[model samples]
Target chain A: MTAALSTGPITAEEWGIVSLSLRVSAVSVLGAAPLGFGVAWLLARGRFAGLVVLDALVHLPLVLPPVVVGWLLLLGFGAQGPAGRLLADWGVTLMFRWTGAALASAVMAFPLMVRAMRLSIEAVDHKLEAAARTLGASRARVFATITLPLAMPGVLAGLVLGFARSLGEFGATITFVSNIPGETQTLPLAIYAALQTPDGEQAASRLALIAVGLSLAALVTSEALSRRMGANVHGL
Target chain B: MGFDIDVFLQRGGGQIVARFSSGAALTALSGPSGSGKTSLLDMVAGLVRPDAGRIAVDGKVLFDSAAGVDLPPHKRHCGYVFQDYRLFPHRHVEANLLYGWQLAAPRDRWISLSEVCELLGIGHLLRRMPGALSGGEKQRVAIGRALLSGARFLLMDEPLSSLDALRRAEIMVLIERIRDDLGLPILYVSHDRNEVTRLAGQIVHLGAAHGVAFATDMSQGEQGKACA
Candidate 1:
């Protein structure tokens, strides 16, 4: 396998893997953010029965093995599963598809996103919201104009963290969607595949460097956004 | 314009029972610390729910336990000037002023942004953030914010307590102008007897026992007379 691998440059095939990884991570973060924020808000402020259970459920992925999470996703969204059957009626499928990979990434990234968002939402002074209410702002308007803006830095951090987590996702994505070449072969999967060969060390190293670069960029972006937003909220 | 308030609230280890009515432009609530002055204001602003009783301003019933009417804070339209000013720290002075103004119905709105800014002398501070504002300036902005929201009445909870003597006097004159010119009923909270005597038309004292005593100061003229 090492003899057959090209150690020169990132081939077009490798580029496809990088692109697919980026797409999967972006889609996962975008799709999960609203749900994450809602869950975070509920955990932060909502008072209700079974709250502890809901919290535990939200954080289940963080503690559970990634393979178990993937297996759970497969059970719920695979072609023959209940949700999968319902989706199939709508002419949609997730099995071995990039969409399935995105779903797996989203599930794995959700806990981190929710945690960051919850902390931020909790930090927002309830007094400000009460003041808004006194000023004739409805609950929705108060959240939109005051609470959400004040929590922007946390929300940004959650998004970047989720995106990075999704990019590096290997166990869940591989277990759920498998390593299909163009459809689901993300960077981690490609790097893993390269490592399995005897002469593919150089190829794996190159892909690993790319992964490191991408994660660094995401973190830097998060820091920059959080700093700017924190300044806007406090300075202005 | 006046206030008719009788509310009962159960706090930790005690109950807060307040009953008073005033037919005056400015009704003062004078009490020592921990006498439920702020709690009563919170009830009027719908921030705190009373166990039972009624809250009416200018003949408009805001909360009536018997009638099962409990309007939310947004619908009550009681402009509150908190002791700490409670200005939205993230918003500029202008945005804070406009927050309520934008929410008010056109027919309900009686004061414009420019008018409030001019009246409170906060026009020059509009672009400044609440973080950068002095205590006096923040209080003025808070007052302007409440007024611009189309408030039918005002609730000032020790609005001058956090200010210096000079700023307190300045705001006292501004409050007088608002009372005489705008004609909006004001429920002012203060611990200083002299300050209340200078500004309040009628004074209601809250004792340490949680009892309320109504006083009509003849020196303040007929406008200071309470009906009950």
Candidate 2:
């Protein structure tokens, strides 16, 4: 609060962190989309047993400390853990790697994505899906042609929220993957590291500005896309 | 040679049992509100399960609780035109027409998209969304969608009830022409006496105390008297 925001340029390392943040967040959102859609569909349409428990579990990451989520992930997916060892044998790794950061970000961002998608999926008219059925369209076909199209706006908004969450992710990522310079470090991590040094405020302030700018851009794009897609579906 | 149905189900407080068979060119299910008319149609279309009953369309068993065979709605091959049209708002008119046709087997494909559009007089509305169309236009598109699916039978539930008087008359004429040209048997459901008198070749009446009544050889005058 005391110092004015820095208008100085970023160093090459800072640029690397920004690029890494985008990549990690992008990968997280892209990888999580299909799974997110599945969870959302289940929550929106499924009436099976333990549904409440499943929903609560999905949102656990949001309420829990990010470090706790990171630790749980590590316990289940660490190098020597059951899943982690299996993956390591296959030459795939998650612990302390960039992939782990993405995974952690994905977990942290999952609830918001699912909530947005669920709302959209629920908004779709069951009658339209029934109509598709009478036309010989199967459940899967009906979802593709009717339910998904009507829910496009929600899906986009979910993706935007997830992407922003992934970018801003720090605690889970740092705890899960550690703050390595070129590997697991992202924009948030970079900012945190910068704030530690006495004269590193300038770099931290610049990175903070980039984060704010990226988030604002994502929100604006999502808003515009949602409105346009909603209008198109509504035929307005 | 035609559709056979013996549907019995409970809804809310009362029981609904409808039994009928008709090979006629156009059969009508006419009843007042709360008469389970739409429920009967939904059972035939495989959208609702008829407890302890059987339904067959052209000798093909679509549902049979005794035999443990209940085909899903997609496999019923019964074209349904809902009262509200239920067209996909996201798709254009052409896509709506093609939706069912695309799911049809190659050998089962007989009606073309342009053919149905031309028949319905919706050729120029191909690129238009459903919301942009008039009530008559939407009804035509819905009919076209059902017909292109190569459905063995058609079940129309108050298809013209949403249209104004002028649009209703116009669409009825279109329906008559399509019925004459295709000669496919239709199960038309409506409470409107005029629509029944104009279109029905057979009548299936359901009521609270009457249960279900089936009458064939329906002439214009007979239908008018029956609905009266």
Candidate 3:
């Protein structure tokens, strides 16, 4: 174990979990970004009676215990659930799989993404939008060029925050997909499994270091990216 | 094309009624500080709905409360330059100038970016952000942005009020050039009688007590006496 720790490659199985964690989290964030953007725009800019209800619903994951959210996902998308059955009939099964892990992480990370983006969208100047209208730009075009560009810093922040949330997503992912090796065993799940075994000290420590390194790297990258984006839009 | 307007607006502690018809290439809306000059511009731009009105631009009915024909600002084909020079803070001078240019339909593309840049003398500042620009430079950029769109009419709401005397005089000279070169009908709004005399071929005087009055084809001295 000491020799393995000193100077050798992590086991292929450990590498698989690392790769799986990355894949699940990346897929989670990418899938959520655009949808989060839309929902956030609506919440920030829209005025309607149903908006309160929608805002609450979108933020439900943040307030709920992670396990409860996972249980809800299981109940809604399990094979016995109507949606799960429909997807099953269509040859797509999400139960106890990597896709399920991603799905769970995306849901867990959604509120952070939306909140960040919403704040950014709200910060955009409505006067500029009015000017764009007078200049013959349609509402969609104005949003694409003006509102989105102005809101990019918040969007980037949300992307990084959601990514970190997905990386560390534990309870929802475990309850929704169940920890299965080579399929749903993300870094967190693999670490948990290592703790349960007799001789997984080296493996767990290695995985922990990798997870910390990745998160720190992500934080640094996002800070620089968002700073540059802010300067591009607003100038120094 | 000309604008014919009869608009009623409800404001604090009073109501505003404006009625005027303008066909001149450089029609000026001269009014006291409390008069509804800017609000009238807003109604024409579709930024504010009138309580009751029939407004037509160049024989096109832009808004008719009785007929229920209210075209939105994007469909109005009117360019606006505001007092505050509302250039997009995120965009550089060039992007702000082109904000409406690409959105203009191909056949309606009357003014080119190079022409506007040359006219406004903002060609060198295209790469710079709006925040870094001087107030005079910002106003020039704003005018360029407004004119780059393929709109047939221009609305200036105290466009020179924010600048110093030197800058204001400089832009006034530029406005004369714009009038001669572009030949689009411009509606210039200002309270300054001197601005009205210099830029307007026709003047609509607006006051809280009188509402609106129109007069045309008088010498500057005669017009100054008439407005006074």
In terms of DockQ, the best-performing candidate is 2
Alpha-carbon DockQ of candidate 2: 0.65
**For model 1, how does the per-residue alpha-carbon lDDT over B79-158 read when each residue is reduced to its tens digit?**
99888787887888899999999999999899998888789898999898898988889889999999999999999999
Score candidate 3 by TM-score against the native. 0.88
**TM-score (chain B only), all candidates:** 0.93, 0.90, 0.90
Candidate 3 lDDT tens digits, A1-236: 12246246776766788899999999999999999999998999889899999999999999999999999999989999888998998999898999999999999999989998898788777877888889997888888887788888879988998998899999999999999998999999988988777887777788888889888987887777667666655551
Task: Return the lDDT, model 1, position A202.
Answer: 78
Chain A TM-scores, all candidates? 0.93, 0.92, 0.92
Instruction: Give the Cα-based TM-score of candidate 2 against the true structure.
Output: 0.90
Q: Report the TM-score of candidate 1, chain A only.
A: 0.93
> lDDT per residue, candidate 3, B1-228, as tens digits?
476778788777667777767667788888677677888888898888988878887788989999998898998988999888888887788988988888888888888899888888889999999989999999999999888788878899998898999999999999988877787878889988888888887787776664442222232323222322
Instruction: State the lDDT at B189 in candidate 1.
Output: 91
- Model 2 per-residue lDDT tens digits across residues A1-236: 12434664565666788899999999999999999999999999999999999999999999999999998888878977898988988999998789999999999999999998998888788888899999999998988888888998899999998999999999988888999878998989988987987888877778888999999998897788678666755661
For model 3, state the Cα shift of residue B37 in Å: 3.4
List the candidate 3 regions with Cα displacement exceeding 4 Å. A1-3, A6-9, A232-236, B10-15, B30-36, B202-228
Best by TM-score: 1
Task: Name the runs in model 2 displaced over 4 angstroms.
Answer: A1-10, B209-228
Worst 10 residues of 3 chain B by lDDT: B219-228
lDDT of 2 by residue, B1-228 (tens): 466777788777777877767766778888678788888888888888877788887789999999999999998887899998988888889889999999999776778987886777888999988889888888889999999998878899998888899998888998788677786778898888888977877777766655443222243323222321
